[model samples]
Target: TKIKNEFPVFKNKVDGKKLIYFDNACTVLKPKSVIEAMNNYYQNLGVCSGDRSSHLLSWRVQELVEQAREKVREFINASSTKEIIWTKNTTEGINLIASSFPFKKPRDEVVLTLLEHHSNLLPFYEQGKRRGFKIRIIVPNKDGSLDLNLFKKIITDKTALVAVTHLSNVTGLIYPIKKIISLAHQKGAKVLVDDAQYIATHREDVQKNQMDFMVFSGHKIGGPTGIGVLYGRESLLNNLFSYNVGGGTVQSVKIHGNNIKVQYLPPPAGFEAGIQDYAGIIGLKAAVNFLEKQNQEEIADYIEKLSHYAFEQLKKIPEIKFLADYQNQIPATLISFYFSDKKVSLYDFNLFLNHELKDYFVAVRCGHHCAQPLHQFFNTSISMRASFFIYNSTKEIDILIQALKDFFNRKK
Candidate 1:
């Protein structure tokens, strides 16, 4: 409740407007606990080389790091802490594994879906282009849901990996991950879930689902930027090869005139190559604490109700088309729409929303939203999206509705 006061962004008005943040689909506002944790990390506990050093201060910082990792492990229910690998963000986590996977076999296939974020797509696509592995793209349902039946057809004995999103960033559709994982495991395929947009918002029981890997971003969930998690199974972690090498990964190295051998540490440390963002990680832990303090079920319900109201109100305008069907129970905080006039470019609509009403809401994104493929299925030229968070209220939705009405009424 007092979170808005801590985030400095809310303190200032834009073009004489009070900022209403609805752009949570892209990133969320951080709470005071997160901010103070970050501040304290540098303001007092700042240090270098968290684990390699022996000094009290350095070890203390390392303790903080481990504590943060434990928080993530507990939050996601990881069987073993060793399985969690820290990355810069969800993008790096996906790419690191995708790029570094040891292609020790003659036949290996990687499966992706159209519902994937680009972070999940391009990495595998690049791997396919470079390494001779077969890449298959599973199609989404007409309603933007993932088609599991389609997955059963493409997965084969040769399939090595399956990477998909737990939730669609654009469509607001949730995928059947447990079923997807079951289907993949039957074919000896490991799955990597892009929880970048899905995690921290939903209730996830990773242990029950038996998911092989899950990755998510910190900034998206109100933690500081430049930090994320890569959760892998213990068996998979043991066999995993690190993509990066630096201070933390190396135990020793032997150099020869023409050959070199570097001894690498095990999974978690081996994968975290360079210097880490200590403060950011600390802040991430606080962010997780703050979220845990709230009731997840209630939060999820609030978002859905707000989303439903926004959708119904938007539908009242005949000159507009919404991107999502109101019937689906995808989280409602985000509602995307378009103007019906042929003369109106999406850019114009976005510009109006961003510039004309910059103060009313702070979180809005315009265009393909890095989800171009999704727009094609919806048959939209472009979209103006308003996202919601715990801070948003129904009154704001009404304000948005009236704004839309005024725009169309004046134009006509």
Candidate 2:
């Protein structure tokens, strides 16, 4: 597909082998359009944004930034640009909500699942420690799916927030977010979806989903790093306190006697303090545009087929043990598993692929994948992950399978 060629990295050779990146769950390779957009921003309108200056160059930069914000709003089907806030990544977005969301009393509860990345898990835990709120955790079923009934039972009147991943980065299992959001709203609780994995392949409409807030990282969606999006309900955002305060976030500052008064801007501006990552934001917009042209549904289907092909091929290996049944899951974009014979650790297998399989240039991830609790539940410290994206193909899956087969044969 031309889409593969759009990523210039694919043209380059690593160790004289064509790069076969299966780590989309970690970060995606940027398309030429995204790279060019970032370069253009640096070359042309490299100036401060917002009301900091009235110069033409500054205004142009501010216009580009606002245009990017509007594009993000449209991408996620947010109600307004005011609801879209710029963040460093999904981690910062979750932290913004964790630190600023109004929790009135000590007994206020924040619920999460076992499938969360550390970015979604730790901020709330730290906030709970400081704010004296109770944190309720819901463990997944044996098959790595959330028990909806158990989720309903755990969230009650005291629940102030429910944060969960839209899709599991490790298992590629999709959560019933619409149902979960409905239940949370019924209990007068807000919902935050970590779309770090989901956004790359699927479409997210915050208004349609009735999500209070949604977060995703730009790098995971073929954009540059250090840029992310936070989509909040306009009313909820206005009610929340500013996460960071500085120059661009304020509407006015006045000195009265010995005291100084600061009137912060509304919603997104108040949340985004100081200078922003203008180049990265532009790159993100370009990435989103590229994905939109490809059609999200088609991308999802292509990646799913690739993942299923990989799963079936790997299943032939008697020593392999899958963490979850991939065939029954919703469109597996990634798969995680460990070797049952324990002849080698996950890292050892990863090193074999990177070093011994240098000619094939297969790249995958290995570790806890920032969900140590989930790994603990599975009774393992680490596992290997092979994630897929639209640019990947069944041919690459075949290459991967052949490499694994060769490894096993040699070991035997």
The most accurate candidate by TM-score is 2
Instruction: Give lDDT tens digits, candidate 2, residues 148-174.
Output: 998789999889999999999988888
Model 1: colliding residue pairs: 20-361, 20-362, 22-387, 23-363
The C-alpha stretches of model 1 lying farther than 4 A from their native spots are 1-8, 103-107, 324-333, 357-362
Compared with the true structure, what per-residue lDDT tens digits does model 1 show for residues 1-412? Answer: 3646757777877777787777788888888789889999888878964577778889889999999999999988998789788999999999887887755564488998877777888888897788777788887766566667888999888889999999777776667899999999998888999987777567676798898889999988889889999998877876766687888898888989979999898889889887789998898999888888876677778887897788778878899876655354554357777877757666665556657764464346777877676687777757888877777788878877877776676677
Assess every candidate by TM-score.
Answer: 0.94, 0.97
TM-score of candidate 1 versus the correct structure, residues matched by position: 0.94
In Å, residue 151's CA in model 1 sits off its true spot by 1.4
